[model samples]
Target: DAGVTQSPTHLIKTRGQQVTLRCSPKSGHDTVSWYQQALGQGPQFIFQYYEEEERQRGNFPDRFSGHQFPNYSSELNVNALLLGDSALYLCASSPQRGWDNEQFFGPGTRLTVL
Candidate 1:
């Protein structure tokens, strides 16, 4: 059994660059959500994916996108990145089932844009 895992732990890029972050869900989890947390701010919902389809999205621009695999893994993609996009990208997983599903978060991937 494994907890949620995210790739690259950290990343650095320049403005206008593109970045892709990956996430592997915890065992028994079926839904994955992506969040962005800027310095000193709480995590803001970016979007959520389930069953390979986007289920919900936040007020972010079209540059944000995501994909969920049949194995419950997911990826978060951001295009035309801006300095304002620099933040900790978190991946959370929960069972897309009946009530009482608890979400578990992974160590976030820190993005630094110059």
Candidate 2:
């Protein structure tokens, strides 16, 4: 079965520009988490949303935002992009009813900021 999926496998942007990435959760999952992984670094949690409500967020600034749809799909939006913003954006999905459940990750969207 298909698992979590992300769109725009690759992206390129200039500093100060904005970008939006999309994701669809795995089957039977309603919780989606977004992560940012820099080169040679592990993924860092950005945020998680469930039931169309944002439930948790990490250290990222307000320039990063997300929205979860009723169908468990989600989108991550970044504004005022910087060169440091270049990274792979990941989307993971898990069942919200379970605590600390296993999250299935998408292939991620590689973003490069010039």
Candidate 3:
């Protein structure tokens, strides 16, 4: 019955550091995807997970990774962060992909890199 949730509404980090963002998907949902939204831009797909496995990945570098738990919760990890990495990290969830079921988005974790 709950919708997607993300931790740390705002975060500040320095270059070369690593940050981990968390997400709890909506109830009864089994798919979660991460996105990066820069200022004034729509989100760019980072990757997606289903059935506790990564099923699809975007054009992002290996520094970006994610994990999905059996419970449908997920985590987004960014390593060796750069100032350019600063953006809004959004987590979305749906019953599953391919079906294009309704997806709910989190409030997003805003990151600022120095």
Top candidate on TM-score is 2
**Which stretches in model 3 have alpha-carbon errors above 4 Å?**
none
Model 2 segments more than 4 A misplaced: none
- lDDT, model 3, position 33: 90
Q: Sorted on lDDT, highest at the top, how do the candidates line up?
A: 2, 1, 3
Which candidate wins on lDDT? 2
Predict model 3's lDDT versus the native.
Answer: 0.92
Query: Can you write out model 1's per-residue Cα lDDT over 1-114, one digit (the tens) per residue?
Result: 889999989999999999999999999889999999999999999999988999999999999998988899999999999999999999999988863766899999999999
Give the C-alpha lDDT of model 2: 0.96
Q: Report, for all candidates in order, the number of backbone clashes.
A: 0, 0, 0
**Alpha carbon lDDT at 28, candidate 2:** 92
> What are the per-residue Cα lDDT tens digits for candidate 3 across 4-85?
9999899999999999999998887789999999999999999999988899999999999999887889999999999899
Q: What lDDT is reached at residue 1 by model 3?
A: 65
Against the true structure, candidate 2 reaches a TM-score of 0.97
Report the candidate with higher lDDT, 1 versus 2.
Answer: 2
lDDT head-to-head 2 vs 3, winner = 2
Task: Report every candidate's CA lDDT.
Answer: 0.94, 0.96, 0.92
Which tens-of-lDDT digit does each residue in 6-81 have in candidate 2? 9999999999999999999999999999999999999999999998999999999999999988888999999999
Collision count of model 1: 0
